[model samples]
Target chain A: MAEGQFCNKSTVNTEEGIRHLLSDTNGKTYYKEMEALEVDSAAIQATFSKTLKSRLKTWLEICTHCGLCADSCFYYLANEKAPNQVPSYKIQSTLGELVKRKGKVDAKFMMDAMDTAWSKCTCCNRCSQYCPFGIDMGIMFGYLRGILYSQGFVPWEMKIGAGMHRVYQAQMDITSEDWVDTVEWMEEETEEEYLGLKIPIDKENADIIYTVNAREPKHYPEDIAEAAALFHITGEDWTVPSVGWEETSIAMFAGDWEACKIQVESVYDAMERLKPKRMVVTECGHAYRATVTEGPYWAGLKDGKTPVESIHYVEWVAEVLRNGKLKLDPTKKIKEPVTYQDSCNYIRNAGLSNDARYIMSMIAEDFREMKPSKEHNFCCGGGGGLNGIGRYRKQRDAGLAVKHKQIMDTGAKLVISPCHNCWDAIRDLEEVYEDGIRWSFLKPILLKMAIIPEHMIPKDE
Target chain B: MLYDYVTGPIALISLVIFFVGITARVVLYIRGLDWRLDRVTYTVNVKYGIKGALRSLFFWMMPYGTRSWRVKPIVTFFVFALHIGVLFTPIFLSAHNIILKEKFNFSFFTIPDALADILTIIVIVSAVVLLIRRLVLPEVRNITDFKDYMMIAITIAPFLTGFLAYHQAGDSQFWTIVHIISGEIMLVAIPFTKLSHFVMFFCTRVQIGMDYGIKRGGMKKGYSGQNW
Candidate 1:
């Protein structure tokens, strides 16, 4: 075969999609920023040396080019075997090129590298599982992101989000006052639906310090209301923090370690002051991973020495159900056949598959299992901050075809994803494809199905 | 004189280079370890990590454990057989054992001559199949380079020449000399080229298991229950 002739004729014309991306205003902004960024070889080398680990070196050396990992990549499968989109090819072209050049490449090369590292791949890590040697493509891409981030080549949306986190300590720039106001508003809204429901803010010594994605307040305030109703119904002492309320970490996704560190530290600082037994993060995949799995390290807290335990909201909900503290009303369960979208960070990264499934089973009348579910599930094409990066929407939408087919094959009326990013991406797919399928977060379904005992009900109601 | 040079001094030098080079490479790899002091700990179950490493080693050895076995069974079989032959034949072949016994008075378990012949044929055939694959498959061919082809040739030479010498199909002395020289070249090349995989494979697998098994706490009851 001719060189660079690796893509089959059947492959989707990704060039057109890329063209669409470049035509967008956000994409133009991203291009302009990348153009303005100075290409310094010394800086690139420093960042690479800093991020390149022994494990990554072994991974680079040991690949036999078996092409088996291609089967695991949704881009390869969905794009009709586009060789460039293959996981190995993606890594080899970007990281491999970087290593070969010793970080002395130019702007055009860095742009191509950024395209492959950021826009094309989602860093979901399914390829790592299929790799016989277990080369983690996700971690490798993360390191690549770090290198690019150090060079100031981050996408505009990611940069904005990270900047927001650095300034306001929350994604979407939700200030401390706005955060408290949203909580109070949700508390009142939830009180009208469920008597005596209160979305506590900055409650000291609470059992759980609840945190949420900023999207919960900005776009989907009902999620906050639903979570509040669940807490009130269960008679649990869970308080939303006035500060560090947003659990989502665009900084981590943007590969800004300093910003990521600050974002994680803010949450821990709030938890430390609140003295909560545990910090229960709302259903946001990257947020849970950032705070619970990666937070302590970023915050300079030693392993096993975190000030408080961090748990995903799904885990907390599952625990509540297991402890019999919350009862599910089967009669009030979601009547539609629902399927669960396993968020990559949650299932693959955090090993919370069982809890997610259990929560779905408890709330939904019929939970349809998508093919290749759980940790092996394909990304919603919005992972690794791709959903936040509007510049790559066309590529993101094209990749969503794989997820659309998976969801369609399940024949479920509603697909429930606990992750805000997955929910957003899947919702986009729903609209774009006109699939006539609704999507939701786990909080709404749980609130609707959970039964509160008569004694727990407010006396006035 | 040729035989003595090929089998004696050359052999010793190759062995020295192989051992020292591998040791140095391994040391370099260890020294290069980032240790990721800044990484947070989800869990530190070293026991599970050990178990997971052993499990991965075994799982990957069997073709059934990988998805490739189903998708590309022919290639998978050839690759698997190639690894078995290349790894086992060197230690177990009667001739190699005899040489070891003569040189260092070291001999281990020996495979029957018939089994050795079968393994030799498998190795030779698998090498050819792998070469054809490198030449034929578009994606694989794209990555294939002179070094890849040279590695295959280096691997195949000893077995091919050994088979010819054993059967006396060619001049026995010539075949034996070629075989000894080829074997020496392979030994010396192991630490320098793609052949390093013979040593690094275990290290890489174990490190992966440690990361996913111990740090991630995903390994449960000998199976990584994360996916299922």
Candidate 2:
């Protein structure tokens, strides 16, 4: 270890190390301690050597430092165009330098990497699209985070986040029993509206297997109930697995590859066991990105794909509505000015922008696009686990200005975002900016706007 | 003797080194790829990869094709102009072709002397502006290191010496020999230094272009436009 003011240092690759770190301190103390901890030159060099390859090496070498990537970054735009916020500078200073120096960096350099990795970037990949050479800072930063993670230079929430996946197979401590209970309770509670809403659990060979972010079960159980209500109205045969219900991977955000595999493998395991025709993940962005795209590789599947074909919530809902399985009440459509928040994980990263916009057209009468729409839209500011990292609260909030201004410019009071992360970001942005903005996840908005069938309507109503 | 050795023997050695080094580096880069890193198959269409690459390569080359290009109109204009001058001036200049024809009995069609002069001046002026931009811009300066400065200096050296030699600046023979040596140094440095981007740019650009075209741009089998 290079000499510095060494503090709470632990080998976090082990289960015991993660357990100790999670129990002993919170996000703030852990961050403070990690910042002070000495840099492990051996660990950095080992990880760097392992990850160094043709594509990443070329990306670092080929960068011309043209600085065009600065405008594409929301952090740069939101931070008054800070020079440090430039995507090229941010990646080059940390990951690029690490490769250049063969990872022989000091404590000061590691601390800089820690701050820039978690706080400065959310891994939105917007800059990736804008780059002429297609140098993805998001991918580079992700690789950088793994190296940082090996040395235990990680955010407190992210450490706990990966631990949660390792322990409970969810981002939170929601057991299989708890998830089943929540679905049953939601079915009963929402029955008053739909009369008979059934949330089938672990039903083998169901046409659709639905998964959700743990936050839905842990914080917003109503989201689960609302999804149940939609499936009920649409008359689709969907079942939620009691064992692998949670789909979001905080481990992916933390660059903890082991925890990522654990979380994604559980879901894949359920799919293989039950053999659903297709899987529909809830309105979560990163969850969809993880499962649909990245998870197959993490799980080491032969085809590099999930066992069953899976689609996002918006993809399923839009198809259902378009094919006339479910109808939207024209009279009940939102009349107020509304805008759509594009989730980087799904909308940009997954090319679900049009699917989301098509849903918006059906749900809202007065839909407006923010300054940039579709794949060109900026990040929601609270992406890549930044929303949950307490140490970066100030920077995260400050970064919301670009998004806040985008919404204000649209003059939309209601924002319809299809992804859970985007929903949280918009809600938080409205709360902090106090622009009198209101927001919703697609589940609630779909439930409110989706017309109930004549037969399924409540008897009393 | 110095001029003859440099222009005749050393120049040939530099060309051989340049070509062989590039070939070896390309092979090493391909072999260095850890298949485990890319074990998972990309969902995007492999067929459109080349098409996408060409699209982005030429599109980015356009004066205002990208948002970044549009953002700074003057920089875009200057960059494209500089590229044209740098690439064309040396190849089309009549003096260089005469030397090539005398040595190898083969020469490319040459431009008029005055046109060559104008292009040389443009490249020289652009190099100076680019150097100043690197020094002055806070963001660019922050990332710029001694190596970057040295690379920039090496790139401009041949152009500056060629311009002086063409104009018969004091001791024309001396200027011409120095220009030949500097040009050869640049050729040898291409594969070893960051100038590898001259070749690797296609690889990086095409890979990303394919990424956008197949995966995120929704060119998959079932999911087409509007359906996405």
Candidate 3:
């Protein structure tokens, strides 16, 4: 009902007399079903009563309408600072109102809530840091999204993303055999350079169980290759399970709670089966968040922990560097004015800020810190699955302007982003800004700078 | 007759409801917290939970402690001043202390009457600025429902009436009665309405601090090399 609130101006808000527009870019089948889906108010009310817990109920009751969370959100700051863009307004107009009305919301109201849930806010949780009452709008939005998903009003990719995790146990459609082939393929390509390099599969009692983002195998197998080589040179024993190898949960992003449980249990299942000493996730932010931080709770693990110890890719790299297990060639260090993207998932959510800085200090000669670094760094605008939503591309780019300015202000030619979401956002941001900025995942930079032991180096060479 | 009933019984009832209602709200939320989902706390380094909560509470209490508070120092000043005046003036005012001394045979320390007057004036000025900000600022105005405007009015009523009654600007007896009634109403509203934030702020800080502490590896005991 507010201005600049809908994802698209033509987006139909009510199932009754709703306009049907073809969606070509976002997931085709899901978007069509969503468009045609009935707006069942009774179902929405039933779902609300079922899900409303004490924490959210109390939070909803306590908000003072201070409008303080406005500047804390990039969506509010970057979108010309509209009133509706404010975090409080976004949640209040949608979920807050839904609660106040006891979920007597109409089809149009649900549509408006859907718009705010997905498009207006990326659920970055930055606002939670600044909220005087600690009203985590991100967490509230996560709950709101569950309501939306139950009523079949979720975004295109989200529905499909949840489906992917449910059907494939991975966010992508890659089968178990395909994942193994990709891991082996990467090892084959990289094994020539480093002796004793192996992509072990389902190796029980290994020291490490390495889980990777499904995106790595589908789009960038080189990341797997680089990880294998680094592990080989460090003399670390790690195995990738055929099943439960995909660590990223788009279901988590989609707010499909049941699917989130299914997805995270897959990884936890791997940990219980293989009995690794620890699990090390790849350089994907949400993957680390889903499997390690939030996944434990979803799977009902004790004290919010995985079965074995779990570490981020950055943490493992930083630890190896510190312990002298991984050595970097001084000559290959990043020489230009370089900046590190403080990824939201691990750095802010998981407290891996020091480890990322350690890696930056180790590898970069001219490392420049963003103005607000560490836990306070702004979101990369693509978090909360903003990168893949085709319908909200313009809004996503507008939000990118906030991070774009943060990056450009450092005047760094090269930006090292350790998380896949941040890296992807940078890549997309660079496409538009074209500031001659080079973006990288931490794996590539580490692989480039890491020194291979002479003994581990090929004897023929 | 109305004054006798209002001051004698209604005031006592208001106090009972205010304290009992707020306690029940806090206890219910804490009790209802699903150990599986909401109450996420650290395992090894539980000290970080206390430390983080204290840090968040301390930083948020100061005028320019958080960046959000620092963004608009002018608003922060009004908000901080308003809160200080609202919290302390009711406790330390001579008239209220005198009433407490008469009823309970005890009284807390009292501020100089001049200082209380100044604090009351600060509260009114801050309330007006906040109200104006809500009306004029488009970002604020959109979220400004009738209930928000009512909350502001309810918050300022006792202070405004007390200031008028103290100065004998109007019918002094009437204004005093209004002040007493308004103050009682405000207290009763706290546990029932959004005004509950006064006490809920501490509860939320405790919950959120643990959330951040456990996630951030505040004490470096985190499973990940979250030595950050």
* Residue ranges of candidate 1 with Cα displaced over 4 Å: A1-30, A304-306, A455-461, B37-45, B66-72, B217-228
Give the per-prediction TM-score of chain B. 0.89, 0.88, 0.92
What does the i-RMS of model 2 come to?
3.9
List the candidates ranked by TM-score, beginning with the highest. 3, 2, 1
> Could you estimate the TM-score for every candidate?
0.91, 0.93, 0.93
Model 1, A338: alpha-carbon shift in Å? 2.4
Q: Which number leads on lDDT?
A: 3
TM-score of chain A of each: 0.91, 0.95, 0.93
lDDT of 1 by residue, A1-461 (tens): 21111111111124443333335556564466465456778877776677676678778776777677887888777787776777887888888888878998877787788778888788888888787678878878887887776665667666566667777777775678887888888887667667777777789999999888888888878888888888888889888788877777888887877888888888888988889988888988989877777776777764423478777788888889989888888799888788999988878777777888888778878899988888788999889898877668788888898999999998896998888889889989987899798888877777667787775456763
Tens-digit lDDT track of model 3 for A359-431: 8999999999987788778999899988988878888998899889999899897988988899999999989
Q: How many backbone clashes are present in model 3? A: 0
User: In model 3, how large is the Cα lDDT of residue A21?
Assistant: 25
Candidate order, lDDT descending: 3, 2, 1
lDDT of 2 by residue, A397-420 (tens): 999999999999998888888777
